[model samples]
Target: MSVETVGIIGIAALFALMAFRTPVAFAMLLVGFFGTWILGGFRSSGAVLITETYGAVSNYSLVVVPMFILLGNIASAAGFSRSLYDAAYAWVGGFRGGLASASVIGCAAFSAVSGSSVATAVTIGKVALPEMKRLGYSASLSTGSIAAGGTLGFLIPPSTGFALYAVLTEESIGRLFMAGILPGILMMGLFMAAISIVTWLDPKAGPHGDHVRFLQKLKLLGKAAPLLAVMVLSIGGIYVGAFTPVEASGIGAALVILIALAMRALTLSAFYEALLDTVKTTAMLFTIVIGANVLNPFLAMTHIPETLGTALTTLGLGPYGSLAVIILAYVALGMFLDGLSMLVVTIPIVFPIIKAAGFDPIWFGVVAVIVIEMGMITPPVGLNVFVVKGVAEDVPMSAIFRGVMPFLMAMIIGLLLIIAFPQIALLIPNSMFG
Candidate 1:
């Protein structure tokens, strides 16, 4: 068989393995190794494998992954996520559908700390769901809000999604983090607006809870202040050039650990567990990254990216039109693939197309993340929906899907706004970096 044909078959086999529930790391590794062997001799393939594996894992920038994950895990162990939710609840829990709105804000805040959509959904769902239920909020709205809000983990600064994207594309992680800030806040606002509209149309779905006095609100704010400070010092420090992404992540993790110890919120066992969790998550991320690195060289040998980019360019679709198609494919794939898997699998193929079409890689990163966020709430494999379902056992799966639809619409609108104004994603990064 021809070398290009081997690459084609390898791509097909990769998808088949994934469809059968093989892990992405394993699938990519297997396909990439053998495909390279088919084209080049065993010696070349083996050398490529060793080189990519070592290079991927040994990358200094990858240290940010574990540090940020540790920061998130420590924050969770310290009960900072709960404090974030409580503070948001105190301020916004009195408005019509206010609890739901607060859930969105809480998710956004915790996402800055947690950086994983599943962690954000699970943490905030545990805190927010019961209260919404107690307040007689509908299961759909309560669960839907939490599930949708969890997506913020992908879009907010310190986000694992963006970190992985940066590593894959060789973009500056700090710039990508800065790029995410405004878009994240804009999407959070759109989510709140969705809640308001839902409650305005059906007040029974989101009845107001007990109002907090001004002093109590201040107290709640104080409780959440440490996390806010950590977020500011880490993410904000990066923006102002005080720290690189890695330093910010290290300092953030250390600061959160100190704060947790100070508050007596984290037991020794809990701290140990947080460290273990960080190690495990970091290991998983790096394995997939290594696998992707192996596959990338194999794909390059086949000229698949060049071929596809030429094919798409030949189609006469304008830049925006071509982008729409790529995004639509992301949305479709998101139904079955997790965000990280989707990103790693497709970026090698689509990134060349994106650049050929004249889109900024940073802007495209934000756009890709938003589409991936949509998938987190999409059906069949909406990971966040499943996380929220585990927390809200009483809420039916279908009902959770139903609840997520409106917020899904909100996500779509936020995406459209960003597309119409690329500056929404670029303003902070450009101003700071330039």
Candidate 2:
């Protein structure tokens, strides 16, 4: 077989392995290693694999991953999730679909501190789902809001996805983090608007509740102050150039540890568990990244991505039309794979096409993250829905999926807005760093 044909077969086999339930890292590693061996002799391929693995994992920028994950773990262990939900519920719970809106607000705040979508979904779901059920909110709206909102984990500052994208693409991590801010806020706004419209049109979906006194609401705010402070210190520091992305991650991790200690939420056992979870999650992410390093070079050698890029450019689709196709592809893939897996699997091919079409890499990163966020709320393999279902076991998985439909619509609209006006994602980064 020609080298290019071999690359194509290897790619197909990798997807087959993933579809058969092989772990993503293993799938990539298996295909990458064998593809390398096929393209070059065993000796050269083995040497290249070893060097690439070490080089990918040993980079200084990669350290940010564990630090950010550790920070998120500490924040989750610190009881910040409850505080955020309580504060949001106190202020927003009186209106129609108020609890659902509150869930989105809480998820956004939690995303600032916890950068993993699953962590955001599980943590906030534990706090918000029962309350939503108690208030008679529709299963779909409550579950969907949390599922969709959890995606903010990657769109807000301290985002793990952004950090990974920055390292992979050699973009500035600080600039990428800055770029996400406005788009994240816009997403939150769109979600809130969606909830309001849904409840207004069908009040049965979310019944209104008695208002909390202003004093009670203010007291709830006090509980959330520590987390709010952490968000400002970490994100604000990065925005103002007080610290680089790595430095901010370290500082944020330290600050979260301190907050957890002060809140008396971090017992020795909890702290140990947080550390172990961070280690496990970080290990998984790094493993896939190293595998991608090997696989991407092999794909580059085949010129598959370049050839695909040329074909798309020649299809007479303008840049916008081409971007629409990429976003649609993400939506379809989202149903079948986890967000990170989708990112690792496709970015090697799709990113070059995006850049070739003259889109900014940082801007495209934000767009990609938003698209993946929609996937988190999508059906079949929606990670956020599963997380919420795990927490609210009484709510059927089917109901949870149904509940997220409007939020999914909201996400689609937000994605469209970002794509239509690149400045939605670029304004903050350009203002702060340009």
Candidate 3:
């Protein structure tokens, strides 16, 4: 069989396994091992796998993954999420559809600390869902907002997605983080706008409440100051070259723990749980990453990406046409795969095509992350939707999915905005790192 044919078969088998509910890491590993064995002799394939595994795990840049995850886990357990929610609620809860708006704002703030989308969803969902329900907000609006808003976790700094993308594509993590800020802010604004339009069209979707005094709001903001400061210092420190990503994570983690201790929110039990969760999450991410290391090289050996790039170039589609097709492919895949798995599986193939198309790697990373974020809230296997469902069990799954539709539309608009004006993502990175 041709190398291209083998590559196609390998991809088909991977998807079949995934459809059968095989773990993504294992699915990739299995396909990679067998595919490499077919392409090269088993002895050679085995040696290559071992070498790739070691290289992936031992790389210094990959260290940022665990450190960032640890920082997020610590912040999650340290009551930082609660403070963030309270601050947003106090400021916005009096406006029409204010509770839903608060959830979006709160999720953005929480994103500053927690880089995992599902973690952000569950943390904010648990804290905000019940209150929104009690205030008579529709289930769709409440659950949908949290699910969609949770995607910001990766769009902001300290993003695990950004970290992983940096390691994979050899981009600067600091610049990638900085590049995300404007796009992230724009996305948050889009969500807020969606909430406003929804509530305005149908007032019952969100009801206003008694306003908090200015002093009261000020007090609530004070509660969130520690989190705000940590975010600014960690993100700012990285941008200004004051610290590396790993060092910034360490500082952020330490500050979060101190804040927890100061608030009396950290007990021995909570601390232990934070450590345990971090270990678990980190182990899972690394497992998939290592598997991708083996699979990516195997895929490369097939010459599929190069072949596709050549074909596209011949077809006269140029860069933008090829990019549109790639984005569409992501949207279709997003329906089935989680964002991380989708990225790990496809980026090795798609990224070279993107680079060959004359796109900047860092700029592509931001756009790719946004596409993955859309998948997180999209249906069938939307991780964020399931997370909100876990929190608001009484609400129908369909309603939650329905609620996220507008935000999903907003995300689509956001993606177009980023694509149309690459500078929206590139400006910060260029200014800061140039």
Q: Identify the candidate with maximal TM-score.
A: 1
Instruction: Compute the lDDT for candidate 2.
Output: 0.87
Better of 1 and 2 by lDDT: 1
lDDT of 3: 0.89
Position 15, candidate 3: lDDT:
95
Q: Give candidates' CA RMSD values in order.
A: 0.8, 1.3, 1.1
Which candidate's lDDT is highest? Answer: 1
| Runs in model 1 lying further than 4 Å from the true structure | none
Model 2: how large is the Cα RMSD against the reference? Answer: 1.3
Better of 1 and 3 by lDDT: 1
Colliding pairs, model 1: none
- Provide the clash count, candidate 3: 0
What candidate 2 gets wrong by more than 4 Å, as runs, is none
Poorest stretch of ten by lDDT in candidate 2: 293-302
lDDT of 2 at 142: 84
lDDT, residue 352, model 1: 91
Superposed model 3: Cα runs more than 4 Å off: none
In each prediction, how many residue pairs overlap at the backbone (N, C-alpha, C within less than 3 A)?
Answer: 0, 2, 0
Residue-pair clash count for candidate 2: 2
TM-score of each: 0.99, 0.97, 0.98
